[model samples]
Target: MEARLKFAVALGAALVLPAAVQGADYFVTRQGNDANRGADWATSFLTVQRGVDALKPGDTLTIGPGEYPENVKLHGFGVPGKETLIRAELAGTVVLRGDRDVDLDFAQVPGRRFVYIADCKMDVLSVHEVDTLTNLAPAADPGALEFGPARYWHDAEAGKLYLSTSDFQPATCHRYTIGVLRDHGVDMLQCRRVVLDGLAAAGYRTAVGKEGLLLPTSGFMLHQTEQCTVRRCTAFFNGSGITINSGVGGRTDQPGEGKGNLVEDCRAFANRLDGIVAYNPSGETIRNCQSFLNQTYGARFYGGRAGDAVCLMSDVLAWGNPGADFWTKGGGLSEYNEAVLAERCIALRDCNFGNFQHGIIGGRNVYRGDRPHTIILPGEHEEFHQFNDAHFADPMNFDFRLQATSSFRQSGEGEAASGPHPYKADIYHVKPGGNDDLDGLSLAAAWKTPSRAVARLKPGDTLYIAPGRYAGDLALTASNICIRGRGIEPVVIEGGLRLAECRDVSVERLQFSGPARAIRGGNIELANCVLFGQSVEAEQVEGLRLNHNLLVASLRLVGCSGVILNGNLHAAAPAVQTDTRQAVRYSSYN
Candidate 1:
């Protein structure tokens, strides 16, 4: 059966016209007019489902801006490269909404495995609107009825709902609000080439399973189909926002394939499960997306063929999530498969684990043996110094009254690489534009004046320093003032210095050694400056320059890439430990 399905699809693909050249328009409007041809803006159907029903190969359904009140399902209709488009009309909002206050019992649908709600809002039921029943008999008093109002009733037996208030009327009232009740939500299967644009799924009643008013069968569930696109949509407060069920044990019995699906620029928040899940599908891509505050992983990739799944996420941020910001369970996103690649992704305040994980809880599988893999860092060089054993003096113990010749003024080996300065500044006080009289009274103002001792003359002028012990850290910010340092041995800048965006700035041949970072600035040249942090103090400093410089953190550069290691890069602390046999080693360079 599966072979026959594949053959049929292959035949279909061969016979279908190229989708890019085919043009057809289907318009949707709030004012229902099915009789009107849905090809123009003026004559449009009110509901999205109507548009879906009318969708053909290579059709582009442009939905006009309005709030729709129905969950529409589009069965299979798609072609590769010529993907059908469903987009919002210019300056308009298209909403898919569920019927308010519908109930059904899921217990009645035997063998029912799943339900799906796509691009719609499921609203909650009001307490007063709930149906009430009472038993009655002849009363002793002529005016009195024999029976009283029934104390309890079931509203929703199985599915879900969207409610207006967080507070439940009766604690048990939540049981009957939404989900599988009579005439509840919509269900779709084997859908293809469907586009849900700028649609919101919200307003669910607070119930046990159907906490939100809109209890979907599932957010965007897929069983067996191909070529679909769900773009620029939001799904919130739903159970399992997006689920791709390929059958039991992450295996697919059907021969039909799910391919060429794209979910992009969408937001999923406060959902019960993962924002998106790809189950046993091949040739799918989820790009440039954001998911936050979901119950489970932000995005999950489960069972699939090797190299069949591709997730390209760039500039994405996930925060305050209980699970890992991005997780791959059930043999997904693991190096074992070599199919997943996560780049430039960040996780802030994620409590579950780091950015990546592998396999189900106990199912550990080694997909790759001792193969050479590349680990890319922000900077150009792969060499890193792990400062675990280095001990630094506590900043709290520092004495500002210490003499200029204090023992703390000594420079480390990497210190001489930085250029020299006149003022003898300590490691913590080496800032720009300051005056000290350690070797001899030297004022920033006097240093600027031209004389035989200085040769250079002018007020508000800056002086360059050579590589040596300086009495004080210089702090100079004057126009036409250029403080050049030696590039050979970085001039030792003793103290921590902070500079902001400035022009005509150059610092070379300087060793910054102290309890704090050496330099912090933008548009500044640090050619051969060595910044050594205090052995013990965790000082704050920007890692590198922004806009334009040798080392930067966040941005990418095309042709420029370099890294500098101050001393022997192979040096490690005695306590450093790793599983020698299990550890993957790589080439080292200085």
Candidate 2:
């Protein structure tokens, strides 16, 4: 037994030693000799395509800085975990360009003749134009070329470019500079564990029948793959930044099951449609992704038949989009499977709409479907748990400042458990005094108060109020400010008070009633208070600690804990008043 244990340990060490020693072997160089063997850095392949062809499983291809005029595809059937990565060696540019000035049918430009490259792990590849020299004409300037009616005459016999309108004329032609044009640029299909990092894909023209560049026509059109990541990459001047749909060519699959894909720290700008469209991708996460100056929606998801299942997005900033910042439209059967979880997502400076829009918005149980299909805010519901407040900046043409009195302030609920997934990194850290807590007024109206009230508190500072009708929305901030009313006639903290990012604050003997919703805060404590709105179902609060308080409307607590009710609090429906014992029943306290 001792001898066998020693041998096993030795074998384990031997296997691990080779993995540590082999540090990035495969390399693609634009200046190195292509004839040399592509095994070592001294003898590397000249083009990215050559290195991709020579790569084996578990090989890391490092592309050196230079311009390479070609589209490369990697199509090797390898096992999972033995994937390939093509990364840039440094912070310089590596261009992947297409062939220019190729004689082809000009009339077929509207048709689908595309320059295509697909199925590879592309990383840090920068593409641009290649400079070429051409002949000169005398009539046109010294180094110029002309192709219009004054320089050349057309021939009716052949439907092509000829010198003359008669039989033919001697044409003085000179070569001119044209940008490297690639059509239907790069496509990845059935490729798992691929990383597209630090690469610029540009100058892709429209093909004869195809509408745009990078046309991924169905059949795992960037789908059905697992554990793939597209990070720090830029997709600009394209029809769609990345159209991830399984049903583009009329092929249907399970809805919202695009699993284990991460698009993080990437930028998509100037696209005609959505920056990133994840159609029917389940368990996919997009974090720290920014989209700016896009024509339409920044990010849109159409979770197909199976419904969008467990899609999470965090720290997503969408600015200057003409449409909604984020849109999730469910497609097929409504089994409550379209679950979209967003955290710390901001839609600032969007030209059209802001953060979110749905047929059913606010609180998961707000919708009366058989299976409870509602938006989950940052609190606890009976069936679902909302962990964060999906915040939105000021809308277009709105002059709301992001001060203590803005809606975006105090918009988030208190922090909850990060969950069991490995990708639950906090994208937006709520600032100290940014209306995160529910102890005071709404953040949107904080600045409208007297400057004296705003300056008296700081982060985490607590303030108590006497029973009086305090007009206007009182904005209470500072990290730990505890505000409480003295008298029990329900110290009416009237007006539109908004609370933001202030935590660990308690409010007592307060009666909030006015044109605005009551207090919105994180980690809030409410004791002996009456939240009397015009109607019993119009208040929007993330988390509330209501004790001996009368809630006249429906209350929602998202992803919160330690809520205890000790006094008479009734759900204000006229039908339930007949029974005195039922007037004060035990509500669920998570």
Candidate 3:
């Protein structure tokens, strides 16, 4: 007798997309009004939500350069050829900020750098800078308030967000804003053949919803969506950067299944948790992406039923991250596990290839740094190769480009190159008796101002500041650059220094004085510097190090993890304060 044969029937009717004609193109601009027709740039829509709502099958929505503080939801669907598209007019110019503007009154605390408010209506994520959109970290306790600029805390029971404004008054500053908790930037739900390109999202946070669960926000979320593409996008400073999930873990129904998603050429960094996550995904493809300096995993693909199709994760760069760089975990029934093809990836730190009984076919991947590389279960990571001394062109400053002298530059047999990207790294110089018109290459022909030197730097570049006194405030916008002082004459800056929305930057042997904010930023390193007569506030920074520096000011850290303080000389007895749940590793602090 023949064995009984059973077939798994797919629930619900199959979604068949009908071919459509070319649709109209709508525009959204910052200068336009929401009540306009939104047909062209002249009469564009004001808000992103308006443009998103006007989208249909085969429709395209183009947004201009500006910040759109709206929680945009894209439920519009399209066919195979004429897909629904939402893109920026200029790549990397449009920003979707998940925050709201606010004006509040506060009273200054006695002998402290903080301000306080007793009663408030809503629980805010943090006090944000209106002009720069910089987020302040929430204070752990009001009683143990750290002396830092823009430190905040939200008392949920009393509905108060603690904000400290030492340089100005909170009520009259007119430069502060706040955001409600867990507001997602862009959510794609029940959509098909949708494409998101050249867009940026930030400022989403975690909050407790009314359902008594901790709800975390994503910069870009795709829920139960199929055939969607996200390319050339950037997500930073959110709860999670980009997430693709089926919502129901192993559901085989149409509404609970997600497949054929593509995420490529995207950058996700400085997020609170994982950079890019795909849960319960089927046939997902994520490639040519950079995920770095995040608090947790750089890329995580997990939670799929047994015997699912092979998912491809390739050409990914994961570096400067504290947690695991690339991780994969299997679902239930581990014997018949999800299959992942991970290749041509670069991990600067940790990489957990697979867990349970998942089959991970990995090859031509480069793993540098001293962190541990882990794999669970038999045959978890079969072809993974570790090069403890991989030669790259300035990997410290986020340049994963292979040099001409590197052995792994050329592929072996059928495999690709080892690293994730291909780019050049350059070095610049800044001196006292130099002109800004110079190319800033050699010290003999260097730039003059610190602002101009930093402006010319890209990721993975190093700027050498000569021994001199500069007078302008520095606001850094680029990430993964190093600024080092030259000579012994003391490279002094008589203004404030701010590094926001960036990661993996290092400053060495510089003197900062006479500024309220001496050194401030996320995921930065300060070593052998003089921070005098000011405050140093670090927010959302992981793997922060303050080493062998003369600190003559108040130091406050918020939301920082893996802190290292070694051989630092302090002017005061209790100058350092932190408001984090993580432990601080310190040695020889005077």
Candidate 4:
């Protein structure tokens, strides 16, 4: 954008569309009995399942703060417009667990597989990488360890556990015993408009099948369902904290049966695999979420096809994760069209990320402390470290917040620094018939191409694109900018939109034709838009909001949080969302 042009504007006002239906609220308390009607706090239900049976449309099931060791299955307790809500009244104090404590002796061990764990304080071991008992040798120190502390090996085939003889005896195993006993904490199958909030889930272990393949599980899952939301929740020490599965093994190319999903203000940590994951495509919106200290990627987006998936995120942080704190590839393929956008996001202290040759990255993002400390701009350059910075308050403590004398906060501000630019509502104009020769001031003299127009824009500026076919690729790096189409005629773009180091961008009322992809941007929202040819992808971005859009290929979202979808999404191909809290509303297939 032009260094001289300056304007600062916040995002559009949130529409107060409508409110959910009012319904009766039920309570579930530990001190209550199963026979109670669960109508009021005075006479609440003991078991959560009994409370589920009594739910109606738009019903609220308030679970008291306590640990509940049981696998919950939520069926069709939701109505069409209104949703069924389940939440802990006290938030973090409530835990829905999936583990059972079992006292053990060395005699019960399958092969004397006991070993020490180093939680980055020294060399550590992970159970997933163990191949043989003989290989459990000691490491030199934390730097030499491939895994982090207090990890144990599980012989899933034999149902045996290998623990440190010095640290854990049957009497001392209570700490380790605070784990999962079942496969899932809450499972949703063919449900609609369901909301889960303020719950903590943990302690899930994998089991080995006949072929020795480890069968993984999730803390909370939505399988073959539509319109679900999870928020203000913590998923830890499980195989996967949260997952949106469409079919068995998450193996399906079908368009995401679930649509318009949202996840916000959640945390996932200390999980076996990824902290958060998504399948079933059709995408989701993520915002203001955090994932860290997990075994693998902090958040991973997958289980969809290349050219079919899109995700949006902004204002998110993924730190202290060994694997690339956030990853955005689908099941087995990495295509340019598929993407995840992360804006004003951070990826700190990750082990590997530079190897991603076709990495989907966009928007004004800040990345530091990673192995490379440089991000691949895909077709733009091999390495681009535009907004990344290594200086921080403290790295050891995972404090990535900028210090008082930080420069990042300075550069983002326009240096006219004090004046109003020559635009109203902080929006500029661009048109097909307009020429680039003029000052490009008004709609009548709008710029013809995006190359010159984008350079003249400032942060919080809006590019009002007029209808007509325009060619050539467009790149946007300015934060809080909106590129919207004028409604008089169909605003068609021939090429694609590339975003890097961008933030709070909204693309609306535009139609992307041919091989055009709005790829690799963060805090992005595409509403009343149609995407064809390639997929629309967002990476490393959080606070995504996608609604009322038609996607011909896919929408890919990776390593994101606080994702939400309103309604009216049509996907011709598969869709994917990885490492995110997902919410879907009233969207349907094409």
Please tell me which predicted candidate would have the highest TM-score against the true structure.
Answer: 3
Model 2 residue runs over 4 Å out of place are: 1-24, 95-182, 205-223, 246-258, 303-308, 330-338, 348-590
Tens digit of lDDT per residue, candidate 1, span 102-207?
4432221123222111111343232212222111111232112112221222223332321211231322232322322222122335656665565555322123
Cα lDDT of candidate 2 equals: 0.45
Candidate 3's TM-score reads: 0.56
Q: Candidate 3 lDDT, tens digit per residue, 433-551?
A: 99999776655567899987898888888787878899977668678999888645688988767777667888888888854232334567888888875677776666677788888
lDDT of 2 by residue, 397-468 (tens): 121112233222333465222211111111111112334233233322222222135446665443334334
TM-score of 2: 0.46
Evaluated with lDDT, which candidate comes out highest? 3
lDDT of each: 0.41, 0.45, 0.68, 0.57
Count of backbone clashes, every candidate in sequence = 88, 69, 1, 71
Find the 10 residues in a row with the least total lDDT in model 3: 369-378
Alpha carbon lDDT of residue 563, candidate 2? 35
CA lDDT, candidate 2, residue 69: 62
**Better candidate number, 1 or 4, judged by TM-score:** 4
